[model samples]
Target: MKVHFIAIGGSVMHQLAIALKRKGYIVTGSDDEIFEPARSNLAAEGLLPVADGWFPEKIHKELNSIILGMHAKADNPELLKAKELGLPIYSFPEYIYQESKDKTRVVVGGSHGKTTTTSMIMNVLKSAGKDFDYLVGARLEGFPQSVNITSAPLIVCEGDEYPASTLEKRPKFHFLFPHIAIITGIAWDHINVFPTFDIYLEQFRIFIDKIEPGGVLIYNHTDLVLKQLVEQHPSSVRKIPYGIPQHRIENGITVVTLEGHSGALKVFGEHNLLNLQAAWLACKELGVGPAAFLKGIMAFGGAAKRLELLARNERLNIYRDFAHAPSKVKATMEAVRRQFPDRKLIAVLELHTYSSLNEQFLSEYHGAMDLADKAVVFYSRHALELKRLPPLSPEKVAAGFGKKDLLVLNEKEDLLKWLMEQSYENVNLLLMSSGNYDGLDVAGFANKVS
Candidate 1:
C-alpha cells in the first residue's frame, strides 16, 4: 500500500507514518515547517519531504491513500489536490479504525489519565510477552514508538476527545468502536471545539454508543458523571466500574494492595489509583490475572510529563506535568498536598492550550489550585498572540481562577524570577503546562533552584 501524509510534522502523524513504513507500506509525507524531533525522526526513516511545502505533484491517483493530520486545514493545497483526483483521504483516527477493523480494539478515554492508563496496560502486556499493537499518546520507557500497528490481533489505543482532523470534524474516540473501553473520568475540556460543558460531555455519550455490541466498558466509578454514563449503556454491553484500590502512602511512596498482596508503586495519587484500577479491569478482560496486573504495574513509572520528577534538593522536590486541564490541575495539586502534608506546596501552571486560554472557559479552573499553599499562573503574551485571542489581564485570570492571591505573569523573565526567589526549603514545587513554559529549560531552572 502507498500512503502519503499531509501536515506530517504533527507528533502523532509522524509516528503513524513511520509505523506504516515499518509495515512495508510505501510512505511519503510533506509539512510546511517541521520541528526538531519530528524532522529528525522522519529524516532517520527516509520519509522526510524533499521540500518544506506542499507539492501537488506528490498527490497522484496511484497513491493508495492520504492520511490527513489535524494540523492541516480543510482547504490545504495537498488535500485539495487529493480531493480533485478522488483519492481516498482519512483522518488519523479513521485510518486507525481501518487498520484495527479485524482486531479486538481496547480504547482508553477520559479528560485526563487516558495516556497513563493506556501506557500501564501496554507495559503489563509487553512484560507478559503479549503480542499487541498500540497507539499511546506519550513515549513510554520501554516502547520504541508511540504508535505501532502490524499483524497483532489486539490493538490498544489512548482515545482522545479532540476532533480527528479539520476535514473530519468528529471526536477521535468516536471512530475507534472499541470491543473494550475505559473512561477514567469526565471533566469539561476542549472549549474551542465543543464550546459548552454539556456539548463536550455529549461526545463521550456518542463514544459509548459507538462501542461494538457485547463489548465491555470500564470506568472510574468515583466520577459521578461516568458512573451515570455506564448505567445508561445497553444491557448487551457489560459495565465494569472500579475505584481506588486498597493502598497506603508512606514517606511520599504509594503501595497498592491486591488479593492480600502488597507492593510499592512508582506512581502515586488517587487519580492514578483510579487509573490503575481501570487498567487492571481492562487487562482482566484480556485474560491477564489480578496478580499479574499488580506485579507489572508496580514498576510502571508513568507516561511522559505526567507528574514527572525533574529534580530533588535535600527535602525539596520539583515536578513537571503536562497538566493544563482544570481537572488535571486540581487532581495533581491535591495529590501533592496529600502526599506531603508537612511540606509547603507551590503550583505554577501555564495557560497554554486553546481550551485553557479561552476566556469563556477560564472559569472551569475556579479553585483548581486551592489546595496548594501558593498558586502561580503564567501565560506568555506571544502564545495569546499566536492563538489570535484577546490579551488577558492578570486581574481577569485571578478572577477566573477565584483565587485572590493567584500570582499571574505574562513575561517569562518575571515568572522565572518569581520561581527563583521562592523559598525551596521543604516545599514541593509543581510546574504544570502543556507547553514548556515558552521553551524555558525545566532541568536547568530546577537545578539552579535546588
Candidate 2:
C-alpha cells in the first residue's frame, strides 16, 4: 500500500507514519513545521520529508490514499491537489476504521482517563500474548509507538472527542464503529469547537449511535451524566456499568479486589481505579479472565504524563500530569491528596489550552484545587497573544477560581522564583498542564527542588 501524509509532524501522526513504514507500506509525509522528537524520529526512520513545506506536485494519481492530519488547514496546498486528482483522502480515524473494519474494535472514550484505560487494555492483551493492533493517545511503557497497525483480529483504540481533521468537524470517536465501546466518563470540554455544553454532550450521543449492532457498551456508572445518557438512549447494544472496584491504600500501595483475587497496583487514585474496572470489563468481553487481568494490570505503571513520577526524595515527591480541564485538574489534585494524606500538597496548574485561558471558561475551575494546601495558576502573556486572546489579569484569575489566596503568575521567571522559594520538605508537588511551562524543564526543576 502507498500512503502519503499531509502535515504529519503531530505527536500521533508521526507515530502513525512510523507504524505504516514498519508495516512495509510505502509511506511518505510532509510538514511545514516539524518539531523535536517527531523531527528526529522521522529522520531516524528515513521517513522525514526532503524539505519542509507542502509540495502540491507531490500529490499524484499513483498514491493509494492521503492521510490528513488535523494540523493541516482546509486550504492546504497538498490537500487541494489531492482533491483535484480525485484521490481518496482520509482523516486518521477514518483510515483506522478502514483498516480495522473486519476486526472487533474496542474504543475507549470519555472526557478523562481515556489514555490510561486504553493503555490498561493494551497492557492486559499484550501480556496475555494476544495479537492485536492498538492506537493509544499517550506512549505506554511497553508499546513501541502510540499507534500499531497489523493483521490482528482485534484493534483497541483510545477514542478522542476532538475533531478528526480540518474538514471533519465531528468527533473522532464517531467514525470508529466499535464492537466493544467504553465511556470512562464525560465532562464539557473543547469549548473552542463545541461552544455549548449541550452541543458537547450531543457528540457522545452520536457516538453511542455509531456503535455496531449487537455490540457492548461498558460505561462508568458513577458518572451521573453518563448514567443518564445511557438510560435515556435506547440501543441495540448490551450495556454494562462499572464503578471503582473494591480497593484500599495500604502503606502508600493500592490494592484492587477483583472477584476473590486481590492484587497491588502501581497506579492509584479513584479515577484510575474506575478506569481499571472499565478496562477489566472490556478485557472480559475479549476472553481475558479476572485472574489474567489482575496479573497483567499489576505490572502496569501508567501512561506517560498521566501522573508520571518525575523526581522524588525521602521527604518530597514531584509528579506531572496532562490535566488541563477543570474536572481533570480536580481529579488529579484529589488523587495526590488521597495518595499522600500526611504530606502538604502543592498544586501548580498552567492555563495553556484555549479553554483554560478563556475568560468565561476560567470560572469552571472554581474550587478545583481546594484539595491542595497551596494552589497556583500560571499563564504566559505571550501565550495569550499567540492564541489571539485578550490579556487576563491576576485578579481575574483569582476571582474566577473563587480562591482569594490563589497565587496567579504570568511570568515564567516569577513562577520559578516562587516555586524555588517553597519548602519541599514533606510536600507532594503536582504539576498539571497539557503544555510545558514555556520551555521549563519541569523534571530538572523538580530534581533541583528535591
Candidate 3:
C-alpha cells in the first residue's frame, strides 16, 4: 500500500512514517519545517521530502491513504489535495484503527503515565514471547522506534486524549476502540483544546464508551475522580482497578512484590509503582503470568524522559522528566521525595507548554513542588513571544503557584547560573519540562553536577 504523511516532522508522525516504510508500504511525507532527529531520521530512512514545504502535487488518487499529523492545520495544502482526490485520509489514530481492526487492541490512556505503562506492557509481552505490534510515545530501551506495525495478533497503543487531528476534533484514544484499555488518571491539561475541566473529562467518557463490548478497563483506583468516573460509566466493559503494588525501597532500589515473589526494579517512584501495576494487570489479561511479568519488568529501565536518570553518584543524582502538567509535576516531586527522604531536593521546572506558561492555568501548580527543599520555575521569554502570549511576571507566577518564595527565571542563562551555584552535596536535582530548557545541555550539566 502507498501512504503519505502530512506534517511529517512531528515526533510521532515521523516515527509512524518510518514504521510504515518498513512494513513494505510506499511512504512519502511533507512538512513546512523539520527539526533535528526527525530530519536526520527521515533522511536516514530515505523518506525525507525533497522540499521543505507542502506540495499539493504529491497527492494523487492512486495513493492508498494519507496520515494526518496533529501538527498539520486543517487547511494544509497536501491535505486539501488528498480530499480533492477523494482518497482515504486518516489521523494517525484513525489510521492505526484501520490497520488493527482485526487485531485485539490494548490502549493505555491518561493525562500522565500512559507512555510508561504502555512501554511496560510491551516489554512484558515481548519477554513472554507474545507477538504484538505497538505504538508508544517515547523512545525506549529495547525498542529502536516508538512505533511498530507488524502482522501480530495484538496491538498496544499509548492512547492520547489530545485531538486526533485538525480535521478530527475527537481525542486520539476514541478512535482505537480498544479491547483492553487502561486509564492511569486524569488531570486538566491542554486548556487550548478542551477549555474546561468538564469538557476535558467528557473526552475520557467518550473513550470509555468506545471500548469494544466485553472488553476490560484497568484504571487507577487511588484516583477518586477516575474511580467515580468508572463507576458511573455503565458499560459491558469489565472493570478492573489497580493501585500501587506491594513495593519497597531498599538502599535506593525499588523492589516490587507479586504473588509472594519479589524483584528489584531499575525504575523508582510511587507513580511508577502504580504504572507497574496497571501494566501487570494488562499483561495478565494478555496471558502473561506474574513470573514472566517480573522478569520483563526487572529489565525495563524506563521510557525515555519519564523520570530518566541523567547522571548519578554516591553523593549526588540528577534526573530529567517530561513533566509539565500540574498532576505530573506534583506526582514527580512526591516520588523523588519518597525515594530519597533525607536528600536535599531541588526541583527546577521549565514552563514551556501553553498550559504551563498560561497565567490562568498556573494556579493548578499550587503545591506541586512543595515537597522540594528548593523550587525553581523557568520559562523562555522568546517562547512566550512565539506563542503570542502576554509576558508573565515572576510575581504572578509566584502568586499562581501559591509559593511565597518560588524562584522564577525567564532566561536559560539565569537558570544555568542558578543551577551551577547550588550545593550538590547529597542533593537530588529534578529537571522537569516538556521541552529541553530552550536547547540547554541538560545531560552535560547533569554530568558536571554528578
Candidate 4:
C-alpha cells in the first residue's frame, strides 16, 4: 500500500507516517516546515520529504490514499491537487477508522486524562502479552512512537474531541465508532472552536451516538454532567459507570484498592485515580483480568507532559503538565497540593492556547489556581499577536482567576529571573500549560532551581 501525507510534520501525523512506513507501506509526506523531533524522527525512518513545502506534482494517480493533517488548511496546495485529481482522501481519524474497521476499537475520550488513560490501557495490554495496535496522543515510555499500526486484532485510540482536520470539522472521536469507549470526564474547553459550552458538549453527545451497536461505554460517574449525558443518551451501548476507586495516599505514595487486593500506584491525585478506574474497566473489557491489570499498571508512570516530573531534590520537586484548560489547571494544581500538603506550592501557568489567551475566555479560569500558595500567570505578548487575540492585562488575568495576589509575567526572562530569586525549600512547583513558556527551557530551569 502507498499513502501520501499533506502537512505531515504534525506531532501525530509524522508519527503515523513512520508507523505506516514501519508496516512496509510506501509512505511519502511533506510540510512547509518540519520541526525538530518530527524532522529528525522522519529523517531517521527515511520518510522525510527531500524538500519542504507542498508539491502538487507529487499528487499522482498511483498513490493509494492521501491522509490530511490538521496543520494543513482546506486549500492546501497538495490537498487541492488531490481533490482535483479525485484521489481517495481522508482526515487522520477517518483514515484510522478505515484501517481498524475490522478490529475491536477502544477509544478513550474526554476533555482531559484521555492520553493518560489510553496509555494505561496500552501498558497493561502490552505487559499482559496482548497483541494490539494503538494510537495514543502522547509519547509513552517503552512505546516506540505514539502511533503504531500492525495486524493486531485490537486498536486502542486516544480519541481527541478536536476537529479531525481543516476540511473535516467533525470531532475526531466521532469517526472511531469504537466497540469499547471511555469518557474520563468532560469540562468546557476549546473556546476557539466550539465557542459555547453547550456546543462543545454536543460534540461528545455525537461521539457517544457514533459508537458501534452493543459497544460498552465506561464513564466517570463522578462527573455530574457526564453522568447526566450518559443516562439520558438513547444509545443502545451498554453503560458502565466508574468513580474514584478505593485508594489512599501513604507517605507520598498512592495505593489502589481492588476487591481482595491492593497495590501502590506510580500516579497520584483524584483525576489520575479516576483515569485509572476508566482504564481498568477498558482493560477488563479487553479480557485482562483484575490481577494482571493491577500488576501491569504498577509499572505505568504516566504519559509525557501530564504531571511529568522534571527535576527533584531533597526539599523541592518540579512538574510540568499539558494543562491549559480551566478544569485541567485546577485539577493539576489540586493534585500537587494534595500530594505534598506540607510543602509550599508555587504554581505557574502559561496562557498560550487561543482559549487561554482570549480576553473573553479568561473568566473561565476563576478559582483554577487557588490551590497554590503562590500563583503566577505567564503570557507572551508575541503569542497573543500570533493567535490574533486581543491584549490581556495582568489586572484582567488576576480578575479572571479570582486570585487577588496573582503574579502575571509577559517576558520569559523576567519570569525566569523572578523564579530564580525564590527559595525552593519545601516547595512543589507545578508548571502548567499546553505550550512551553514561549520555548522556555523548563527542564533546565527546574534543574537549576532544584
Single out the weakest 10-residue window by summed lDDT for candidate 4: 257-266
lDDT of each prediction vs. the true structure?
A: 0.90, 0.93, 0.92, 0.92
Candidate 3 C-alpha lDDT tens digits along 158-266: 9999889999988999999999999999999999888999999999888999999999999999999899999999887899999989988899899999988799999
Q: lDDT at 404 for candidate 1?
A: 68
Instruction: Give the candidates in order of lDDT, highest first.
Output: 2, 3, 4, 1
Steric clash pairs (candidate 4): none
| Tens digit per residue, CA lDDT, model 4, 1-450 | 989999989999999899898889999888999999999999898888999988999999999999999999888899999999999999999999988989999999999999999999999999999999999998899998999988899999999999999999999999999999999889988888999999999998998998899899999999999999999999999999999899989999999987667889988899999999999889988888889999989999999999999999899989999999998998898899898899999999999989888888888999999888888999999999998887889888888999868899999998999898888889998999888788889888888778
lDDT of 1 by residue, 245-348 (tens): 99998888999887777888999888888888888889989999877887789889999999999999787999989999999999998888888899999999
lDDT of 3: 0.92
TM-score of each: 0.98, 0.99, 0.98, 0.98
- Model 3, C-alpha of 275: deviation from truth (Å): 0.4
Q: Which model is ahead, 2 or 4, in terms of lDDT?
A: 2
Residue pairs in candidate 3 whose N, alpha carbon or C atoms collide under 3 angstroms: none
Clashes of each: 0, 0, 0, 0
- Residue-by-residue lDDT tens digits, candidate 2, 1-450: 999999889999999999988889999989999998899999999999999999998899999999999999999999999999999999999999998999999999999999999999999999899999999988788888899998899999999999999999889999999999999999999899999999999998999999999999999999999999999998878999999899889999999999889999999999999999999999999999999999999999999999999999999989999999998998898888999999999999999999999999988989998888988999998889989999898998898888757899988888888999999889999999898888777877988887
